[model samples]
Target: MVFLVCLIFCFLAPALEAQVAVRDTVLTVRPGDSLLAIAHRLLRYSTEYTAGELVDRIKRENGLQGDAIQMGQLLDVSLSYAELLDQPVIRGTNFAARGIYITAALAGSRRMLTLADALVAAGGNTVVFDVKDRYGNLGYASSVPLALEIGAGQRAPIAQPAKMLDALHRRNIHVVARLTCFYDARLARQRPDFVPFSREGPGLWSERGKSNWVDPSLPQVQEYLLAIVREVAELGVDEIQLDYVRFPTEGNLADAVFAFDPAVVPKDRIITDFVTEVERVLEPMGVLLSADIFGVAAWGREADRRTIGQHLPDLLPHLDAVSPMLYPSHFEDGFERIDRPVDYPYYFLLQGCQRLQKLATEHDVLVRPWIQSFDYRVTDFDSLYVTEQLHGAEDGGARGWLLWNPASLYEIGFAAIKGFTDSTAATVPVKLRFPKSLGMDLTRPTSVAD
Candidate 1:
């Protein structure tokens, strides 16, 4: 199939290439400059090019053989300043995305229809649902060969993915397939050679004692992930957002062992190479790719990033956007010297956004944080509480924000964004209906009154 596309692209290549203006701006390399550093320094949030993309252009133009750049060396950048800030819309939405997270369970349920209506009515244009969840389960039936080989699709939660896509796509929602790449219990159990290990045993690397990760260092694991990505892209989803794309974050990290390529490739490189390959393969499919990273990752913490194998700069070259899980409740008490980070969502989130934007924007990548929507730190989380975090994200210059509600509950969330409704007068539909054409079980208790 890809071969056919390549053949067509080759024939139309000249005409397609003609559409690009191919602008250039020159810069002299400074003392501390490398190709990557230059890319980060000059690249901006623009549809014209990603930082790595422009850097690639610079290399091609300058006829460079390696990453080596000396001080006073002249380089030509293919993007102008104006082009750097221009945000071209994808599926009719800007990089400044406003959306929410829906779990695999709720995605397959009837509630999503009403929730979809509520989201659309609330002026949100984007929605992200699960395709593959953290538990190593395929949320929907996958055309990927490996998924079927391993029985990952057995008793799938989302039986009618095409139908669900139709329902959501009809509402003009930008659907992103959320796939957990490395944190897969199913994949680990089925392919023990693909999982992390230690002297302790199979479950040596885990979060909270649940070590079910498919090691990123394994080439076999990457192949499986690529297959899943290709299948998801074919599902007509707008974007692919990888969750848990990092290494195991919990339990006996010091003793954990990788079955392949250990002590050779750096953790960050492993993650970057994996994501880079996924992006390379899927870009032709017209699906945008993004990865969820730890909130501290945006700050470029060496230890933090190395631990998770997700360095913001390394990932920037390969993704459409990077979403940091900035749930304030997840932070520690001594975070940034704030004794109680939970009590100060605004402080931590705002700070996180500031640093994150600095790191992400330089690479021509955008930051869309997963802000706290569910009650965790605030026992009395109200509209104002949620509002503060939302505003903080905006104030810190986040391109967009996505609200995370684990149980699919969003009462305070809705109340907080009441003004988003187009009509001032209160009105609600008596019953919400899913598209019967999708062949879903229509019998569902309604909570989201349209």
Candidate 2:
């Protein structure tokens, strides 16, 4: 009987070893903690397991078919070497990559070479091509009938949008689709009844006599933008960035009017409602949704409340990342102790970024600032000045930064920034210049030194 029992125990031991044991562990879901974060922490303890492998184990044990771990939810985690080895491999974040913006015409033509040359000159590792511009036009051919009816679809300079994405992906270059929302002039024009007009009549919404925007309070407008976003997601792009998400700023406010329906809701609820709806439709699609807010929004102080109705807390929950347009040239007087706003670019940029970073941490969102890369007010483009802005963003605890040169010219500015090598066959390594105190534990939340 003893020999038989030993034989049974030996056979069962192998099976038991393959199975994971559940154990309770205390974990504080820090700001920015996601389902991926929890898996990453567990894999750190189990040397043989990676985050992806541990995620599979956690899902199997928890009876989860999808990734949706909530903040502060205590999870039971365990893993085995054999199970881990069978799991999928995870990719590392490309920290040094910078994003570039390209227009539909440029992306489609052999002028793509010019754009590529510009990217190479600027040390850019990512390209954000416009799938839909402010006109609400699709850069590529669309199957959506509304897109055809409204004349919103186009066969871009690039024969196929998917081919462009695939080429970028092959180069290990991250591609983001820029979908301009709310300020869609084309849609508003076609459907004048849906346009936000002055109290006078059914006319177009104009800002500064240069651009026109759609009414945010309109449900039909929201649906149109969502359809474009869905089309971009299906293009196999890495991320979809929503530009002009807010109301038009520099316009005739007193003369301007809203076609906003009083029956549907209140004015305060309009912006938040639109953002929430967009997130709800986009989140489960396995793509990231990012929104651009004014630099002042990051201050958490309602400075431009009337024009740019963006409040930090309101927009935080609806986004994967928040990019504040911290262009120093745009600020008014008395910012960063500079009597002349444009003269002190570095100082204002640093201070503004710091404020924005603080707001991002409080709301548990990632900060990726749009820094000034072009010389607007200044007669000469300063390379060292650009480096200072980069330092400022890094000092303020930005995860990554992007340079904005409207014409795609960035030779001087890129040369000045540290850690970027020139576009040549034999390149020299340049040390990345980051503030020592601004150390980012890629696996953990950001913290400012006390």
Candidate 3:
């Protein structure tokens, strides 16, 4: 009988490996434990379901709402990987997502349609629109309770995000919802406890002499952020792009007091944990989760990673892709031996590509970089400059890239697109940056009105 049972199990193993993320264990929720945190501890080795999805499974199995869990509640979870082997990949064009960032205002207005048509003509396949921007405002009406509590819907700039997403979907465009994770001035002002303490006092902290950051460690903060993410995921976005996921370094550094684990843990670890939590929840939903980091990350700065709370190697395990904002202009002069890094666009991103190659291989995460679209600190910048950035990224082995124009004007970028691709019929227009969160639109145009 034993021999027969062993033979049967051996035969079933291969089949099981390809078709199941099965229930392999049961866990009891503990006091103060968020469902995602518990899943993170339990599924450290899981490849099939992210900790967030595991949390979802737990909630479904236990009939819980939101992230709430009673202490000692028994939860059943999956552990099989073979089942996920047949799971469908991200829902979009299988090709690399060559794309651009569309402001909420543009997307919410009539110009969004024009922009979408233009992008399609430019040989672009993806449109990553801002659902929740840097100011902590929602572009769409969010269903999360905390979102409602904080008047996120009231502050929404995009009148109808769902319809807008549907319109893009018809174009077969992969819609990646961008959420400015922590650099939310609105959320900070509303929940002062969430932001780090300013140097001047034991109170709220802000970056750039403004803009408060969300504390990554707080349970409420994590749940609040993830709730919005979940709502957006349900809206059928192909991916959830998380921006500003790091600890601040731009302003008042010495006096900034992190509310959660300020002295107990490293900043990079905190950022990693927060993203890991998001990955855990989003993975089960089968939605792609990406985090945007400072371009300096790819340049290989361990110190910078630690200070900013975005360590590439550490974050790889929990992310589908890591977008290092590799804009050459953001780098200092003499960066990578170039007198002005911005002028030598090809080499600036080339080094980043070569550097990220090893990390991407080691971690198996996609490296989709963000390129410069606006004229920032450059003299006589033109379409050629934009093409250099594109060629640099492609040659450097970046999977894809997104163009960023704070003012929503991509005339220079359009010119580059025209020169690089065979597509000639394109119109370069001046699009005003839309109204946004964080009090004002920092990138709004001086000549145009919203």
What lDDT would candidate 1 get against the real structure? 0.70
Count steric clashes of candidate 1.
1
Q: List, residue by residue over 1-450, the lDDT tens digit for candidate 1.
A: 432343334333332311333334456777888887676555431122234555676789899987788998877655432211111125622456778888877877668878888877676767888888877788877767778877888857665565567667667677888988888888877777786767666445555566587778888899999888888887778899988888877777876778555467778888888898989878888788888888877556678876888777668878878888888788887664555667766655667777777656667777788878888867667766666677667767778788888887877676655543333323222132111222433223211111
Q: Name the weakest run of 10 consecutive residues (lDDT summed) in model 2.
A: 81-90
Residue range 1-450, candidate 3, lDDT tens digits: 432343334335554433433334566667888876776565423442234556676678677778767897776655543322222225542247778898876776667777877888777777888888877788876778877878877856565455566567667677888998878777887888787777687556667767567777678888888888887887777899999888777776776776656567888887888888888888888888888888877765667866887777788778777787888789887554446666666655555766776777667777788888878887757876777777767766778788888877877776677667773422222121111223544233221011
Model 1 clashing residue pairs (backbone): 429-450
- The models' CA-based lDDT, in order, is 0.70, 0.62, 0.70
- Model 3 scores worst on lDDT over the 10 consecutive residues at 427-436
lDDT of candidate 2 vs native? 0.62
- Considering TM-score, where higher is better, how would the candidates rank from best to worst? 3, 1, 2
TM-score of each: 0.71, 0.68, 0.71
- Give lDDT for model 3: 0.70
| Each model's Cα RMSD | 20.9, 18.2, 16.3
